[model samples]
Target: MVTRGTEILVIKRNDPAWPGLTFPGGHVEAHESFHDSVVRELKEETGLTIKKPKLVGVKQFYDDDDHRYLVFFYTAHDFSGKLKASNEGQLFWMTKDELQKQKLAYNFDRDLPVYFNDNLSEHILDGKRDELF
Candidate 1:
């Protein structure tokens, strides 16, 4: 998440597999560090160069093939760049209440606590249920 005052950055993804409002991020590239990947992805997807993005939480689930998929979540309060949207989606800044009203990407709503709750560091989704830790 990238924030400026009361608003947080969000993307309306064009990806068919997981389309709708969600934070901007992408897969980690081979040989890249997790921290570096977050910085790179934010730049590529949102045209922002984030500095010192603090890792806040993670989301994990299994794909259709039963392979574990992990999403590393980070929050950045310091960044600089003209806000622009890439092919991934349209970008917007919305407050928490405003964000709650928007259509979120698949399971993203369920994943929000991990981002907003200081005590929660992980969200796990099994095929049958959701778990937080």
Candidate 2:
């Protein structure tokens, strides 16, 4: 997550695999750590450089296509650079209230509370194909 003040950077995806408003992230490439992948994915998707992205949660589920998906949910507070749009779709910053009004991608609604509630720890969320985007 790329954050400034109370707003967060999110991408409106174009990929059918996962389409809609969501945080910028992708598959962790071979030979790259999760931390490095987050930095790279953030740049590729939103043109931002972030550091020390702490692991917030892990979302594991299968999509409508029956493909298993394991997502590493991260939150970054320190970052730099101007935002840019990619093939992923558009990049936008929204406050919590604004975000609450938007149509989120699939089960992201289940992840929101953990992000807003400080007491929540790194969690493993499991679901089935019916819960996908």
| Candidate whose lDDT is highest | 1
* Candidate 1 Cα errors over 4 Å, as ranges: none
- After superposing all C-alphas onto the true structure, candidate 1 shows an RMSD in angstroms of 0.7
Q: Which ten residues in a row have the lowest lDDT in candidate 1?
A: 123-132
Q: What TM-score fits each model?
A: 0.97, 0.84
Residue by residue across 21-84, what tens digits does model 2's lDDT show?
8888888999999889999999888888898898876666665676767778789989888889
Clashes of each: 0, 0
The candidate maximizing TM-score is 1
Error at 86, model 1, angstroms: 0.6
lDDT of 1: 0.94
Range of the 10 consecutive residues with the lowest summed lDDT in candidate 2: 124-133
Candidate 2 achieves a global lDDT of 0.78
**Pairs in steric clash, model 1:** none
Q: How far does residue 70 in candidate 1 sit from its true spot (Å)?
A: 1.1
Candidate 2 colliding pairs? none
